[model samples]
Target: MAIKPSKGFIYLLIVAVFVFGVPSEAHAEPSYAKYGRAAMQETANRYPDANIIDYKYEGHFETSGARNEERFRLWLRGSGGEFGVRVHVYVAADTGQVRNVELEEIAR
Candidate 1:
């Protein structure tokens, strides 16, 4: 004799397939994405001789009204050696208009 599945077991199996088979919706990038791009572009421009090895978004911080900062850390390799750079892109909190950018070279 062959083992057979009951009607309820078949229904549950079908439900499970429909529930977990389809892929989930795609995720959107963060609001501060523009600032991150600006950081990368500006860093590349400033250090034309250096090649960016890695990029990491640090976080967001509010300084004053309508002013905020997006922090990032970029690892770069140059003729001297490898080093880390902290790039800060300042922007308006509400509008996201870029105000200024500050780049600092950190000791490795």
Candidate 2:
């Protein structure tokens, strides 16, 4: 007997695809090397002649397992007493891209 797919089955299939189709970059990791590069560019773009001297990744890095979310935090510095910015960024380990960025420290 040739069994045909019911309308309900088709609808369920469609819904399943829709629900699990798009993937979030929640499992990605931030590239420690390029993180500084792009951040320097962004800082320069805003500051204009902002001399970035050094940077460091600070805080705890946690990966998603059962009790943590994948995230990393970094701190950046620039010339002329530029130790006023702490860049908190979250990244997805699967995509290796920044998921969120929080720039703390505004020049006064």
Candidate 3:
């Protein structure tokens, strides 16, 4: 014969699950994602007429004096033409604030 759990015990279990939910591992967003957003926004700002067709994350690197850069290449199509731009989004290492953005046109 099998014994059943008491209603009070089942109630407690349901309450616990409702309050805490199921246990699961936490996932963190990659560091590049934040900087990548900046890159995308700046690219749009600079090339207002262009539509980004492709994006590639090249690398993340630290620069002099608490500065870091997220490098990416974006291909865009606009009224002017289709081209590629290498974007560098430099940010403050501690605060994640934008320090500078640099764009260079490249042959695609």
Candidate 4:
């Protein structure tokens, strides 16, 4: 006898591909490599002696109706100890100029 595919099996495969193939917003990485670099540069400027071990893009937030900022968390190792810092890279949406950078230490 010849083997044949079931209708249920075919439907399941289609459903699996539809669900798994689509990229979700939460799982997608932002196209903000330049912004991330700018944030890292600012972090380096602030902690000249500290070495950045790792970093991640937390996400972007709207500061105001007209302003939006990209947030990043940087892990650093210094002579004192290992610590994390949050960097807020503010940029103008219209002109794309870096407005300001705010750094805050993350408590362990």
What lDDT would each prediction earn against the true structure? 0.91, 0.56, 0.88, 0.89
Model 2, span 12-74: residue lDDT tens? 999999778966567456536565555555555655645655566554366563222222223
Ranking by TM-score: 1, 3, 4, 2
lDDT of 3 by residue, 43-87 (tens): 999999999999999998878779888899999999878999999
TM-scores of the candidates in the order shown: 0.73, 0.44, 0.70, 0.69
Deviation (Å) of 45 in candidate 4: 0.9
Residue-level lDDT for 43 in candidate 4: 90
Over 4 Å off in model 1, which ranges? Answer: 1-27
Better of 1 and 2 by lDDT: 1
**lDDT tens readout by residue for model 4, 1-108:** 998999999999999998999888888766777899999999999999999999999997878866789999999999889999999988887776788989999954
- Order by lDDT, highest first: 1, 4, 3, 2
Count clashing residue pairs in model 1: 0
Name the lDDT of candidate 3. 0.88
After TM-score superposition, what is the CA distance of residue 93 in candidate 3 from its true location, in Å?
2.2
* Model 3 lowest lDDT segment of ten: 22-31
Scanning candidate 2 in windows of ten residues, the lowest lDDT window is 66-75
